[model samples]
Target: MHSVIETPMYLRAAKAAGMNDAEMKAVVDHLSMAPDDGALMEGTGGARKLRAAGRGKGKSGGYRIVTYYCGKDVPVFLLDIYSKGDKTNLTKAERSTLREILAEVANAWRESARRKAQELRRNDHD
Candidate 1:
């Protein structure tokens, strides 16, 4: 079985964002076991997005998945869990939330990558 590494930082961020344990666990399971396809889990927001990239999940359980690239080969990091709005229009609040979530995830991914790199370097030097 493949092992997924969700550093404690991820859990902390999820908690900071008000994600209950169950919800965070669900996303982690889905992300870890997901096929290695480069499927795009596009963002919500609207038709005129400037820096937006994740969409909100609708009633069907499909939500926006923002991914942060770790390296040239590492699997993209799953950002956050977002619930969709009522219609085609994305409220200002929703967009702001989406950006905030993605930023947080990106920061985490970068940090993870740095740590992993440092470990590898230390191992190689030894």
Candidate 2:
């Protein structure tokens, strides 16, 4: 199973957002540990429902949480931290960036499995 990972930047940002380290840790911790919440994860591959509030706006009136799900087996939904004042609600640029990031994460796991599959193939050939 994949392990949960967090960044120093996110730690500080979460704190600034009023979420303490413990709270942040708790969120990242249950990422895979907890059952599927409202949505599975649109980024993985499936239907989605963006937060009706449109994630609101930040100091510059352009920042908010973008919630979505990818697919069924995703296990957990992806939460994107960005701004809504950019273009449109859940616009292409936003989706593109989110897709790239999600793809990177998924690609890592796929790469590991691919290596294992190749090893099995070599063994069979031998």
Error of 1 at 86 (Å): 6.3
Give the count of colliding residue pairs in each prediction.
Answer: 6, 11
* Model 2 misplaced regions, further than 4 Å: 7-9, 38-92, 112-126
lDDT of each: 0.46, 0.45
The sequence of per-residue lDDT tens digits that candidate 1 reaches over residues 52-77 is 12224333433333334434344545
For candidate 2, lDDT tens digit of each residue in 91-120?
556556766766655455557878989999
Model 1, C-alpha of 94: deviation from truth (Å): 12
Deviation of model 1 at 106, angstroms: 11
Error of 1 at 55 (Å): 18
lDDT score at residue 29, model 2, on the 0-100 scale = 58
Top model number, lDDT? 1
Shift of residue 36 alpha carbon in model 1, Å? 4.1
lDDT of 2 at 123: 100
